[model samples]
Target: MAGPLPDGDQAPVDGLLSLEEIKGSEARTFHAYVHIPFCKDICGYCDFNTYTATQLGSLKQSDYAASLISEIRFSAQALEQSKLLPRKFSTVFFGGGTPSLLPAADLIEILSSLEQTFGFTENAEITTEANPDTVTFEKFAALRQAGFNRVSIGMQSGVQSVLDTLERSHNPENVFKAFEIVKGLGFGTSLDLIFGAPGESLEQWRESLEAAIALEPDHLSAYSLIVEPGTKLARQIKSGELAEPDEDLQAEKYELTEQLLSAAGYTWYEISNWSKSESLQSDHNLAYWMGQDWWGYGPGAHSHLGSVRWWNQKHPLSYSKKLEDKISPAVGRELLSIDTAKLERVMLESRTSKGMSISDLEQLEAGAKSRIPQLIADGLIDGQLAIKGRLVLTLRGRLLADAVVRELTD
Candidate 1:
C-alpha cells in the first residue's frame, strides 16, 4: 500500500510561495503536472493512487473536465492573491492512472485551461502518458491538434511471460505499434522500460532493452522494479508464489543498461533516464530534478515552489468535493529548511550527467567531502569531472546512488 497521507490541514496561503520565490529576479522555469486518477485496469505490481472507471462511483467523467479546470482557475487566483506574475508554462505533462484512458477532448480541455490562465512557452513541451494498449493513431492526431507534442508509452517488457507476471495486459507488439503511430504523427516519443521484475532473468532484461532500442525512441527511462508493501506483487513474494527481486542482479542490470544505451547514442542525463540528445530529454522531469517550480493538479498531485512542498487530497471523491466546495484540496505541506535544501540539491544534481559543482560539494561536512577521492578511486565518481570541478558519477556510482547520497548527506 502507499504510505499514510501526511496529517495536517491545508497549509497557510502565505506558506505556499513567497512573493520573492514567486517573483525572483531570475526567471524560473514553470511547469504544470495534471494527474488523471483513473485507469481501466490496476496492475498487480502497482500502488499508485488510482481507480478504475467502475470503481469511481459518482465521479462522472462528464463532470471531471470542468472540475479540473475549476481547480486550475483556483490556483491562478491564489497566485494573483500573492501578487506574483505567472509566466508561460515551460512544459505540461498529463500523467495518469492512464491519461490516454480519457477522451482526446478531455486532455485538450485541461490544456486549454492552462493556456487561458498561464499561457505556454512558445517552444513548450506538452506530453501525456499513455499505456501502449489504450492509444490510437486517430487519438494521437486529436492530441496533436490539441497541441501535445510528445507521448510516453509504458512498455514494461517485450516478453509475454514477463507481462503476465506483472499482470500487465498489453501485448508487447502493441508497444511498437503505439511508437510507430506517435512517430508517424511527428511527435516526440519516449518508452519506459522496467527491469528487475520478479522471476525475470538478466537475458530477458537485455532482450526487452534491445527491443525498445530497435524502435529508436527519442527518450528512454529504465527503472528497477520496486515492490511496494501491500501491492499484489509484494503479497505474492511474501506468500512464496513469486521470487523476490535480487539486489545484486539489479545492480548488474543497471550497468548493462548504461553500456547498451550509451552505445546506441543515448545520453544518460539522469540515473534511470536517457535521451537521444540533451534536447530530447524530458523538460518537465528536468524541472523537478533541477529543483524548479511546478504545480501538480488533480487528486493526489504534488506541487512545490522554493522551500514549500505540498500534495493534494488522495481520493478522487474527496478531491472533487473540496474543489466543488471552493476550497484548496491540499492535504498537507512541509517547508524545507536551508540545510535540507542544500542536501537535496546535491542528491538530485549528483545523479545527473551535469553533476554538482566542486565548490558546492564543499558545502557538506569535510568528512563527507573527503570521501570523494575514495569514491573516485573505487570507480564511483568520475575523476575527470572531479578534476574539472564537478561531482559527476561513473556508471558504478549510479548503481550505488543511494549509498553515495547517504555518504554525502548523513
Candidate 2:
C-alpha cells in the first residue's frame, strides 16, 4: 500500500478540462501510461500503490483490462468535449506492481483500445515493466506482435542474499533468461538495479552491476533503495531488526556505479539512468522530465496536461466503480501556478544531461542566476557547460543533486 493521496481541488465527474488548462497542448508531445496495480507478492521495501490477490477482496484480475479500456474511451470523450485537438501518442508505457502478472492478451486489448481511440505516432515507443519470473518467451513474443517495442525487466540484484533481503520473488537466474527472451524478440531491453540495501556490501553491489552489464542491455537504471515510512523495511529498521542504509556507503556505491558503467560504454543521461547510446534512452520517462502531456489510465495513476495534474482513485475497486458508473476515476486535481510550473521545470530538467538553461533560472529568480558561479566553483556543475548557457551537473553534482536544486531554487 502507498501513502495517502495529496490534497487538491475535487475533480469533475465528466473529466472535462478547461480550455485555458489545455491550451497549446497540440504543440506538445502526448503519451499514455497504463498502470497495473496487481502484484503476486508485495515487496518489503515498496511503497507504490499495489495490491496482492488477498488484499483485493472483490476485484477480479481477469476483469481489469475491460475497466482500463473504459477509462481510455472516457478520456477521449473528456478531451473531445474540452475542445482540445486530437493528438497521437508519441509513447505508451505500462508500469505497475508487476505488469507481467496480467495475461498478454489483456495488455494487447487495452493497447488496442488506446489505438482505436487516439492512434499512435509513427515510430512510437511502447514499453512495459516486467518482473523476471512472471514473463516467458511466448509472452514477450505475443507482446511484440501486438506492437510493444521495449521491455524493462526488474533485475534488482544479482546476489541471492540481496534479493532475499529485498523480499523479491524472482529467482536471480530468471533475469538473464527473461533478458534473452526479450532481446531475441528484437525489443529494446533495459535492466533495473537497486543498491544500498540494508546489508548490501560494496562487493555485492559490484556483482549486481557486473551481471547487468554482462547482459549488454541497451539501457540501465541504477536506483538507491529508499525505505519509505510505513513499509515493512522501515518497520524492521525501526525495530532494530535490520540496519538502515548508510548514506556514506551509498555515496561510495554510486561513484562505483558511474565508474563501471562508463567503462562499459554507458553514458548517464539522467542522475540515475544510463544508456549505450542516445537512441536507446527511455523516451517515455524523458517525456515526464521534459514536461510533456500524458494521460495515465488505471488505478492510482497520475496524469499531467498543460498546467493541470490529476490522479485517479488509489484502490482498484474504487477506481473500477467510478469507471463503471461512467465517471472519471480522478479524485482530485491541481492547476499549477506559473511559478510552480517554472520551478518544476527547473527541478526536473536540471537533473538531465540537457540541463536547465541559465536564462530560465535568471527569469525564475535572480538569486538562482547568482548561484551558478558558486555552483561551478564548488565543482558541483560543469564550468564549460555553464559558460555555454546550461547547468549540467558534474559527477559530484549528480550525487548531491537535491542540494544543487535547493541552491538554484533558493
Candidate 3:
C-alpha cells in the first residue's frame, strides 16, 4: 500500500476553497481539465492515476461521468454566486487514461455540462485525448458537433517493437487513420510520442519522428521516458527483465529531435512540445507553463487559481461518494509563498519559447543575475536573445533545461 497521506492532504468535504476567499479571486481564464481515469488496458510504464476494468470492479462509466459533472455544477454554482464565473470557459480539456473510451453520449453530456455551467468561450479550444485504437470517424464527428475543436491522439511510436515493449495497443497504421479522420473532420490535432524506451535506437527514434511529421499534425509532444518508481516498467528494470534507458543516448536523441522537428517547420514551443504555428498552440497548456489558473474535476484531479492549488481524492468510488454527499472533495491544498511562486515561474518559463526576463530571475535571487553571463558564455542560451532582455534556451540549453532552472533557482 502507498504510505500515509502527506501533511495538508487529509481531505475534507469543504476544503476545496476556504469559501471566504472565493469572492476575491482574480483568475482570468477558467480552463477546465476533466480527468478520465479509466483505460481499457493499462500500459506497463504508466503511473498516472488510472485504473483498468478489473481494478475498477463496480464503477460504471456513466456514474463516473455524472460524478464529474456534479463537481462541475458544484464549483460553478459557488463561483457564480460569488460573481467570479467569468465569461465561459476559455478552454475545456478532457485528458486521461484514454478519454476516447468514454461512450460518445457520456462525453457529450459531460462536455455539455461544462458549457451549461461555465459557458464555453465563443471560440473555445475544446480538446480530448485519445488512443488511436479507440478513434473513429463517427466518434470524432460527434465530438465536433458537441463543440470539441481539437483532438490530441497518442502516436507513441511508429515502431512496432517499441510499442510492444511499452505495452501500447495500437498499430502505427491506426495512428495515421486517426489523424486523417480528425483532420478530415476539421479538428485541430496534436500527436503525442514517447522517446528513450528500453532498447530504442537513434535510428528508430528518427524514423518515429519522420512518421509523425508525415502526418502533418498541428502540434507534437515528444516526452522523454521516465521510469517512475512503483511502476511495472520500473520494477522490470530493477529486476533485470528490462534495460534502463541510457542517459547519454537519451540526450543524443533529444538533440536529434530538435534538428528534425525544426527542419519540419515545427517550432519547439515547450521543451517537449512543437507547434506548426502560434495559432495552433495548446492554449490550455500555455495556461500551465505561464502560471495561469484552471480547475480540474475527477478523481485525482488537480486545480489552481492564482497561488492556491488543490487536488481531489484519488479513488473513484470515494470521489463519487463525496459528491453524492454534496461536499468539497479536495484532498489537499497549498497557498504559494511569493518567493515560491517566483521560483516556480523561473523554473517553468525557462522551458518555453516565451523566454523569461533576466530582471525577473534576479528578483528571485540577486545572484541569479551573475549566473546569466556565465550561462550565456556556456552557450546554454542565445547571446542575441539575452541582449534583448530574454533568457531563451539554446537547443543545448533545452536538453539541459532542468539544469538551467536549478542554476537560476539556486
Candidate 4:
C-alpha cells in the first residue's frame, strides 16, 4: 500500500465547489475527462483501475452506466446553478481500461447526457480510447454520430509473439483492420505502440513503428514498457521470468522513435505523443501538461481544480454503491501549495514543445536551481525556464524525460 502523503492526514474540505468555481480561474481552455474502468479482458501488465468482465458482471456494468449519467447530472446542475459554464470547450476525452467495450447505445446515452448537461463548443475535439478487439465499423460510426471526432486505438506491437508475451488480446491484423475502418469512416485517429517488451528485438520495435506510420494516423503515441509495482509484470521481473531492456538500449529505441516520427512529418508535441500538425494535437491531454482544470467521473478517475487534485474510489461496485447512497466516492485528495504547483507546471511544460518559462522555475528553492545547471550541461533543458522565457527539452533531453521531471519534483 502507498504510505501517507507528505502531509500527515487526509481530510475533506468543508464543501465541494461547483464546476464553475473550479474552472473560473483558468483561462486557457475548458476540457473534461470521463473515465470508464470496464474491460472485456485484463492485460497482465496493466496497473490501471480496471477490472475484467467476470469481475464487473453484467448488472454491475449496467449500474455503472446509470451512475455515470447521474454524476454528470449532478455536476451539470452544480455548474448551471453557479452560472459558470464556459462559452466554449476545447476538448472532451473518454479514457478508460477499454471504453470501446461499451455498446453503442450506452455510449450514445452518455454523450447525450454530457451534451444536455454542459453544452459543447461549436467545434470541439472529442476523443475516445479503444483496444483493437473492441473496435467495429458500426460502433465507430455510432461514436462519430454521438460527437466523437477522434479515436485513439491501442496497438502495442505488430508481431504476434510480442502481443502474446505482453498478454495483449489483439493481433496485428486486428490493428490494421481497425485502422482501415476508422480511416474509411473519416475520423481523426491516433495509434499507440509500446516498445522494449521482454525478448523484443530492436528490429521488431522498428517494425512496430513502421506499421503505425504506414496507417498514416493523425497522431501517434509511443511508450517504453514500465513494470509497475503490484502488477503481474513486476512480479514476473522479481521472479526472474522477465527482464526489461537496459537503460542504454531503451534510450536508443527512444531516439529511433523521435527520428523516424519526425522524418515521417509528425510533430513531437509532447515527450511521448506526436501529431501530424498543430491541429492534430490532443487538446484534452494538453490541458493536463499545461495545468488546466478538468472534471472526471467513474472508478479511479482523477480530477484537477487549480492546485487541488482528487481521485474517486477504485472499486466499481463500491463506486456505484456510494453514489446510490448519495455520498462522494472520492478516495484521495491533495491540495498543492502554490510553490509545488508551479514546480510541477514547469516540469511538465519543459517536456513539450510549448516549453516551460523561467518565472515558473524561480519559485523553486535555491537548491533546486543550483541543481539544474548539470541538467542544462547534459542537454536535458535549454536555458533557464523562468516564467517569461519558454525553454523546451532538446531531443536528447526527452529521452530521459521522466528522470528530469523526477529530479525537479523529488
Candidate 5:
C-alpha cells in the first residue's frame, strides 16, 4: 500500500513516499534511472519491455516526453522532501529499448528539468544507452550540452555476421562510427559486448574483443547470452534454428574476455562490468547492485524503494493514457516485509564485489547464519570486512553469485 500524501503532492501509497517527496529526495545524493521504451526493432534475444518503430510512432514521442517531464517534476519534489541525503545527484542514467532514438532536444529538455527540479552534483555522472545506427555527431554534441558526461554504446559484437545473427541493425562499422562520434563529443564512453551467440566461433569472438579494445572505451560490459523464457530467441532455440553456446565454450569465452580486458587495463568492478579507471565505473548500476533505492520511469519501467517494488504497464497505449490522466502509472507491485528486506540486501550484496555488512546480515533470519561457513569453505563467498560496513564477495565468489544469494536467503 502507498503512504499518505503530504501537502501539495500527489497522493502517496501507505509505505512509499508521496510523489512530491520522491522528487525532493531525488535531488539529494541518489541515482535517477529514466527509461525510454522505444526501439527500432526488438532483438530476438531481448525480453525487456520494448516496442518497435510502428508502436513507437503511434505513441506520440512529443506527448510522452511531456508526460515524462511531469513525472520527473513530481519525483524531484518528492525526493527533495524525503531528504534521503544532503547532497545532489551522484548519477543519472537514460536506459531503455533504445534511448538513442530520442531527439537531442527532447533529451535536453529532460535534463534541464532534472537540473531545475533536483540539482545535480558538480561532476555528476550522467549516462545514456545508445545504439550505433541511431547516433549522429550533432545529436551527440547536443547530448553533451544536455549534461550527459557518459555514453554507453551497445556494440553487442564487432563481427558483422554476429551482429546479423543477433538481429542488430548496425554493422561493425556503424558501431565504430558511433563510438568515435561520442568520444569526439568529449564524453566518457563504454561499450556493451556479448559472447556465446548462436553460431559464433571463438576466433570471431576474439576478433570482436580486439575490435572493441581498439576503440579504447573508458569502460566495458561483457555479458554472456542468456536465454530467458518468452523471448523470440528462446522460441528459435526450441525450433532448432538457434543453438545456445555450450557451457564449456561459454566459460572459455568468459575467461578470454577477462584476460583481454584486464590486460588492456580495465578493472572488473562487478561480474560483467569493467572500467579503465575507478571513476569511469557506472555509479547508477552499482547503486542497484548495492541494494539502494531508485525510481524507474517510462512504460514498463521498474522501481524499488524500501522493499516496495513496482512496475508500470508495458503497452504504450495504456501508459500514454495513464500519463495523460496525471495518475501514477503503476501496473504491478510487491510489498516486502522486514524479513524480506533483510533477505534482499543479503542476496543482492552477494552478487557484487562488495559483500553484505554483518550488521545487515544479522538482521536476517537467525537460521541463515549456519549456512555462511559452508559457503565460505566451498569457495562460494569470502569472510566479512567493512568496506561499506561489512564483508563482500571475493572474485571467485562472484562467479556463483546468484546461487550463493539463493542459498543465503533460502
Candidate 6:
C-alpha cells in the first residue's frame, strides 16, 4: 500500500471530458499504461501502490486481466464521446507490483484488448516490467509473440547483502538467467538498479554497476534509493536498526555511475537513465516528460490529457467496483492553468539531455530569461548550450537540479 492520494476535485462518474480539456488532444502523442498492483512480496523500501496476496481481499489475480480490459474499453469510449480525434497508441507500458507475476496468457489478453480498442502505431513500443525470479523462457517467448518488444527487469542490486537490506526476494543469479532469456527472445532489454541503500558501500555500488554493464542491456536506469515516509525502510532507520544513507556517499556513488556508464558508451538521456544510443531511450517515459497524453489504468494509476490530470482509486476493490458498474475509476482530478502548465513544462524538460527551449522559459516570466546568464556563470547550466538557445544541465546542475528549477521558475 502507498500513502494517501493528493487533494483534488471529485471526478465525474461518466468520466466525461470538457471540450476545453480535449482541445488539441489529437496533436499530442498518445500512450497507454497498465498498472498491475499485485506482488508476491512487498519490498521494504517500496511505496508504490502494490499489494500482496493477503492484502488483496476480494480481488483475485486470476480475474485481474478482465478488469483491466474493461477499463481499456471504457477509456476508448470516453475519448470517442469527448470527440477527441482518435489516435493509435504510440507506446504501451505494463508497470507495477510485478507485472510478470501474472500468467503470460493474461498479459496477452489485456494487450489484445488495447489493440482491439485503439490500434497501435507502426512498430510501437510495448514494454512490461518483470521481476527476475518470476520470468521464464517460455513466458518471454509468449510475450514476444504477442507484441511485447521490451522487458525491464528489477535487478535492484548485484550484492546479496544489499538485497537483504532492501528485502528483495529475488535471487541475484536469477537476474543473469532472466537477462539471457529476454535477450535470446530478441526483446529490448533493460535492467533497473538502485544505489545508496542504507548498508550499501561505494564498492558494493561499483560491483552492481559493473555486473549490469557486463550484461550489455540496451537501456539501463540507475536510481538512487529514496526512503519515503511510512515505508518499512524508513521505520528501520528511525529505530536505529539501519543507518540512514549518507548524502555525501550517495553523491560519490552517483559520480561513479556517470563515469563507468559513460566509459561503457552509454549516454545519459534523462538524469537517471542511460542508453547505448538515442533510439534505445525509453520513449514511454519521454512521453511523460514531453507533456504528451497518456491514460494510466489500474488501482492508484495517474493519467494526463491536455491540461487535465486525474488518478484512479488506490484500493483494488474500489477501482474494480467502479469499473464493474460501468463507471470511471478515477477518484479525483485537477485542471491546470496556463501559467502552471508552462512552469511544469520547464520543470520536466529541464531533467532531460535534450534540454528545454529558452523561448519556452522566457514565456514563463520576464526574470526567467535573465537567470540564464547567472546560471551559466555559476557553472550550473552549459554556457555553450545557452548560446545555442537551449538550457542544458552540466554535471553540477544535475546534482542540484532543484535549485536550477527554482532559479528559472522563481
**Predictions in order: lDDT:** 0.86, 0.94, 0.86, 0.77, 0.76, 0.92
The stretch of ten residues in a row with the least summed lDDT in candidate 4 is: 1-10
Candidates 3 and 6 compared: the better one by TM-score is 6
**Candidate 4 lDDT over residue span 242-361, tens digit each:** 886577888888989988899999999998999999989988888889878777877777766655677766777877876777666666777777677766776777778887555456
lDDT per residue as tens, model 5, 34-100: 8887888888888777777676666676666787787776555554556544345668899887888
Model 5 CA lDDT for position 46: 88
**C-alpha positional error of residue 330 in candidate 5 after TM-score superposition, expressed in Å:** 1.7
Error of 6 at 331 (Å): 0.2
Misplaced by over 4 Å in model 6 are none
Better of 1 and 3 by lDDT: 1
CA RMSD of all predictions: 1.8, 0.9, 2.2, 3.3, 5.1, 1.0
lDDT of 3 by residue, 256-338 (tens): 88899989999988999999999989999988888777888998888877567777888888888889999877777777777
Residue by residue across 52-164, what tens digits does model 1's lDDT show?
A: 87899878866778878978998998877777676689999999788998888888989998999999988899999999988898898999988999999999898999999
Q: Which order, best to worst by lDDT?
A: 2, 6, 1, 3, 4, 5
Report the Cα lDDT for candidate 5. 0.76
Question: Can you give the TM-score per candidate against the true fold?
Answer: 0.96, 0.99, 0.95, 0.90, 0.87, 0.99
Off by over 4 Å in 3: 1-12, 15-27, 81-85
Candidate 2 regions exceeding 4 Å error are: none
